[model samples]
Target: METVQSQSKNSSTDHHDHGGIFGEKTELYFAIISGFFFFLGLILSKLTPLPEWTSHSCYIAAYFFGGYYTLLEAIVKTRKGEFEIDFLMIAAAIGAAYIDSWAEGALLLFLFSLGHALEHHALNKATKSIEALGELSPKTALVRKGSTTEVVAVEDLKIDDIIIVKPNSQISADGVVIKGSSSVDQSSITGESIPIDKTAIAPNTKLPKFEEIDSSNVVYTGTLNGDNIIEVKVLKLSKDTTISRLVKMVSEVETKKSPTQLQTKKFEKWFVPAVIIMVVALSFAHLVIEETVRESLYRAISVLVASSPCALAISTPSAVLSAIARAAKKGVLIKGGRALEDLGSLRVIAFDKTGTLTEGKPRLTNIIPINGFDKNEFLEMVLDVESLSNHPLARAISKDINSEYGIENKHRSSDIQAIQGKGIRARYNGGNVFIGNVEMMKDAKITVGSEIHQQMDELLQYGNTVMLVGYNETLIGLISVMDVPRKLASQTLARLKKIGIKQMIMLTGDHQRVGDSIAKQIGLTDAKGNLLPEDKVKAIEELQKNNTKVAMVGDGVNDAPAMAISTVGIAMGAAGSDVALETADVALMSDKIQSLPFVIGLSRESRRIIKQNLWISMGVVALLVPATIFGFANIGVAVAIHEGSTLVVVLNALRLLRYDLKE
Candidate 1:
């Protein structure tokens, strides 16, 4: 088996891998040394005039190097009253030597050790996809101090320190770009196929609520700088960067065993001992049958080697780990194998409309001034009250007022207060100003004029959230804001449908009209509106009662319970919520809605590959066991077929690294 090296207790993440390597170089070097001595022994005996003792010495040296770690592990396991695949392999080689076939035994050890070396090299490359992410960040950064810049180690970089990211270099920390402009290759962090242009924002600009880092103004660690230089003020310490958190999450996920992997471990627990007992039976049965001990012993050893279960042990993990690494490299972080496998079997998928299906950011669409009030002055008053609150609609109004109306800060407000569930109130320019819904206007004892009332109803019917602007106890203006559906929402849902998801529904806390409007725009089959967090959970539970697996996709925190109960919980990277990123079963780091299909496609493919690998492995065993017992296969043929299947399982898993989502 390819796992001879990993059989050592010291070199593996899971000793029961039966056949896996973490790609350590020391084992590979020792395995090479073992092979060299084995070949030297063969050369001395066959082609050289060396004495027989010299050849024997070479064979002894080969066995010592090849069997050192395996022998140690077998002894340690025996003392504990345990059986390991390592002991099985050691028994096979020693039995061959007992039959006066030192050359055959030495050859077995040589090939086993060399097989482990090659497995180490190949599996190492497969696991390196994740290791490489941690390595993408530069070792050092150029920090600006006063008027001079000096090189500082990345770990030494502190918050609020100004760092200069020169052109064609990696950004060393996550920070806001206070100066300069450039495009960045954010694919490693955001999975954006195109380089995004990052322009500097004012140092004190207030970001929207729930945004982790400003996508347009903030540069993340490990993203490449473009042709122009940009100066970034570090927002977090080196260890707290997004890249570091992802690395930490990956480490945590590695320890979690998937259902199949747990089953495999249990299988190994009984299977190894059973194989040992079966070999013993074969060894003794030959005596009653009057067969020669050497021939019987050789066949039993061959069966032991043939049925090592190396390929079966690695079938799930190799594919699972490689798929995880591939996803992480592309900016999709699947927390563990459970999430990966769950993604494959989703029957019904529900989406949170606000951030998951539509752009969570709302934009002011229709601004109307009522009763001959000055439009600019009305907006100015509205902005004064709106700016005092951080509500989505208020922010949307402020953004439109500042960008479109281009108003100078003339109107000022005092005693501003936010009324929960209604809107905001403030005293502006010698009178009270209100910026909220109809309920807020009603609460303020202000009535909408007949014409303005008609328009508000029309906006509401069209799925717009209307903000009523009241001034001095009079209805002054109306601002309609709408959250646009994501550009890829329609296409992404269609892709999910094409991929055999039985149902797609939108779950939203927004009004039924608003939810249905967006759902229609995105071609979703159904929309459930005004759903509280608990309501969402109940909805998913109802779907599950129908014998369908439900997947809940949301902003992560608000949908946590629903996500917990669903078959899979997917968090959008756009949420920028740390709770969302750290807690979701799967996090779409790219924040691109189009990547959803890829997540499903890859997990399903990975599961299929695992099954294929298992069949290939067990199929080889099914044939080899019978053939070895019937005297049709010897140690060499068994080793060749058995180890060849292990390599095939590993190589098959590695193909996931090259898998790409089709457009």
Candidate 2:
């Protein structure tokens, strides 16, 4: 059955870890209950010539006590049209009862229950490393209103709300300090294990230290407030906060199957039927040649039990669970097991242009003023118009103008009209300022200088998309804003290629120049640009048609459809939009592109482990079936071997929990 969380809980390791604890407790409860019935049956069987009816009742009770859950699960699965290992085990148990081996039936259930308990316990221990992740913001924030402190839910906060931070309190929102200084622990957010000192940071200054204790003017989310009391103005609300975004991204990591998982499923389709046929044929031949139907039937049951698909059934999930836990340790959250399995077979990975490979946030990479206009004047004009707009280019222009010119545009604009898909038109300084793309300026009859065109063209070569901001009939300046590449992007791409990835491709909605520039920088073999979400899906389908398994990496609404269409979809959880995260097959919890190779390595290792376990299980069945049929092994030994095979398969699959990858 599919399981989904009812509420958007804090993305904590606790949410996932608690499921294991639940399973473990349930197992222990079942085991204890089964043991009680087993003892009761033993007592009743020997007590005072107990009636045949009474003895049978006790035996049945003991059998049902241990196997009832399995029976229920089998029925549920039947309704769902999936006949699984649980059904096979139930059939085996009932067959033992039919053979008048009541005690043996009870014993088999007991052993199976015990094995389940052990598996849950082991799985719980293996996943313990992920328990610390998903710690959320403290439920409450200390809001400071004119020096009076009051506690409130973090979600209730609004922009510019002044919040107070006490020593050792987790910072509730992303904000800047208005007062005080202290050292903050930021290890949770940045993976640095040091307390950073934060003095009042100016609006635009140098980078803050990773760690130093001076909480005077520091601001970061999920970091500890130092020993000094400080006031902060909230820059973003809870839903828009960094941790909130991360939690959302984590929740959405891709859940689709990778190529390996699909192959495993396909293999099982054939492997299961073939093994069943072989087991039936060998048993029936022995029945025709050997003396007793009882012995032959027993041999057949042993073969069936020995060749149980439990190992195969368990292989993919165990390996994937282990891989996900390992990723969590490194600050990555892969949502589904299928995604981990598919990541290994990815031949080409398409990336979303805006955010997946680059910092989604655009910055002013270049600002060129034309026609003898003073750069500052051009900047002021553009910034004044852009400050009134919310487009990415506008924001980038605003941030750049403020950073470079040391002036905040306080002058208000009148009659601002934002043209959809073009630019913003506003009355500034008694003139119409058109700050937008060339289309916008052309529509407004604005002409740009030749030098500005040359500068814009040059910016495109470096992977930047330039926006033209013009006044009246002349272009004021060209603001070159590009999606910033991730710091580890180049090295991450190189590592991906080294891991046997061929035909690297990049897909984006941006212009061709931007896509080509990024593709070249990242050593891509090909690049596609100006693609919509559906277009991305077509590209993935094309790759599949050409026999190239592809993984699409994206971080926006536009990537959601492509993610669902790819062989493997990797969502950039660190910067991904909520829909992208929820739809992708695998999500990299952090914005680290390097984890792609790590995931692939883990999947390949897991697939190998699954194959090894299946063979081991089959080998046990092959050896035990012959011994039972030839009268070399008694019912006792046969039963032991049958049960032991199951145990061996389980133990082999458990090895995936500690399986290490070279990546």
TM-score of each: 0.61, 0.60
Q: Where is model 2 more than 4 Å wrong at Cα? A: 1-87, 96-300, 309-317, 331-338, 369-385, 390-392, 403-448, 461-463, 467-477, 574-579, 635-663
Query: What is candidate 1's CA lDDT for residue 378?
Result: 77
User: Which 10-residue span in candidate 1 carries the lowest summed lDDT?
Assistant: 1-10
RMSD of 1: 12.6
Candidate with the greatest lDDT versus the true structure: 1
User: Over the stretch 1-663, how does candidate 2's per-residue lDDT look in tens digits?
Assistant: 000010001111223244433453655467557767766776777775777667677668767666765566557656866554555667666766766767666766665544444333333211221122234466788887775878988879988788888877889887777677665655344322224456565555543432342333546666777556777878778877656654443333323333443554455456445655765675576546845765667666655544442333344344455666777777666655445555766677777766667776667787777778998788777778888764545666788778877977867677888664466799888888887777898898887657667777788788776778777777767777767777777787888788888777887766677778888887778888766445666787788886777788877655665666677767888777555655665778877787777777777776666567656655665776566546576556766665565566556656656755564
Candidate 1: tens digits of C-alpha lDDT, residues 1-663? 212323431234333234324235655676677878888998999999978988788888888877765665677777878786667767767766665556656765665555544444433211342364467678999999999999999999987899999988999998888898877866455433235568887768775432456567878888888767899988878888767765554444334434444454565578779988988888876777878876677778778767754565466667777888899888888865557878998868998876788777677779888779998787778777777765545667788889987976564888988664466788887788888788889888998667777887878876787878888788887888887788989999999999888899987766788888888878999998866455777898898885577888876344555665677778888663454454467888888878888989999998888778878988998999989988898776776776688789989999998888776
**Model 1 off-target regions past 4 Å?**
1-274, 372-377, 388-393, 404-408, 412-432, 439-446, 449-464, 482-484, 508-514, 529-535, 574-583
